[model samples]
Target: MLGTDDELSYWVLVLTGPQRGKVWLVTAVGAYPYPYPQPEAHGFAEWVQHWKTHDGWWS
Candidate 1:
């Protein structure tokens, strides 16, 4: 997890997986999948890069 707010409404920017490189977002727990799996970009740096260009997340 590279960045996030103190509030625990969601475990934002969470890194989970065997190797711990996957990036999950916008959920109360890790990889819950109720709202979003949201894990698209693999590595933290890659996820950041995607965030820099993604539509809704950046807006």
Candidate 2:
């Protein structure tokens, strides 16, 4: 449930937590075109890093 309107060209990140916790991280590429898909787009690197950084083997 993350996407930008035509008026705004940016990426939206939706992080849904357990038990209905949700977060959104919205940022603009600033006139540059983003060639990535929506779900696998923003915060993936950081997400992976954080996942490995904190939740190692706990999942």
Candidate 3:
């Protein structure tokens, strides 16, 4: 999960299987390994871009 600066928090996740390489935005409730909703992107490149954009913020 990729955490955001917000308290409730937004997360970017890379899924596997049929949805492999897809990106998803999740709303975190408690701690690590938060529950995710659905995939927001189905492309690997899109996922990479999202990760890079948030990497600096969440790193």
Candidate 4:
């Protein structure tokens, strides 16, 4: 899920997967999915990371 804090004016990211669950504080800056995974390594973390980075949740 994705949401924002009106007072703080920041974005939030919630991630859930088979391997783990995590939350991230996102900003409208930076590039797409800082750490991308290769075709051979498609783990849960990599899957979530790809979306988190490329999806532009902060935007």
The most accurate candidate by lDDT is 3
Find the 10 residues in a row with the least total lDDT in model 1: 32-41
RMSD of each: 4.9, 11.0, 7.2, 10.1
Tens digits of per-residue lDDT, candidate 1, 1-59, equal 45554465342444455635655554355443212434343556665665677633322
Ranking by TM-score: 1, 3, 4, 2
RMSD of 4: 10.1
Q: How well is each residue in 1-59 modelled by candidate 3, as lDDT tens digits? A: 55565766655555666655544445454432221222234454654564577744222
Best by TM-score: 1
What local distance difference test score does each model get? 0.46, 0.37, 0.47, 0.39
Clashing residue pairs found in predicted model 3: none
| Residue ranges of candidate 3 with Cα displaced over 4 Å | 3-5, 28-40, 47-59
In model 3, where is the ten-residue run with the lowest total lDDT?
31-40
Model 4 C-alpha lDDT per residue in residues 1-59, reported as the tens digit of each score: 34454544332333555322434444465212222222232334644565677854333
Better of 1 and 3 by lDDT: 3
Q: TM-scores of the models, in the given order? A: 0.40, 0.22, 0.38, 0.25
> Which 10 residues in a row give candidate 4 its minimum summed lDDT?
30-39
Ranking by lDDT: 3, 1, 4, 2
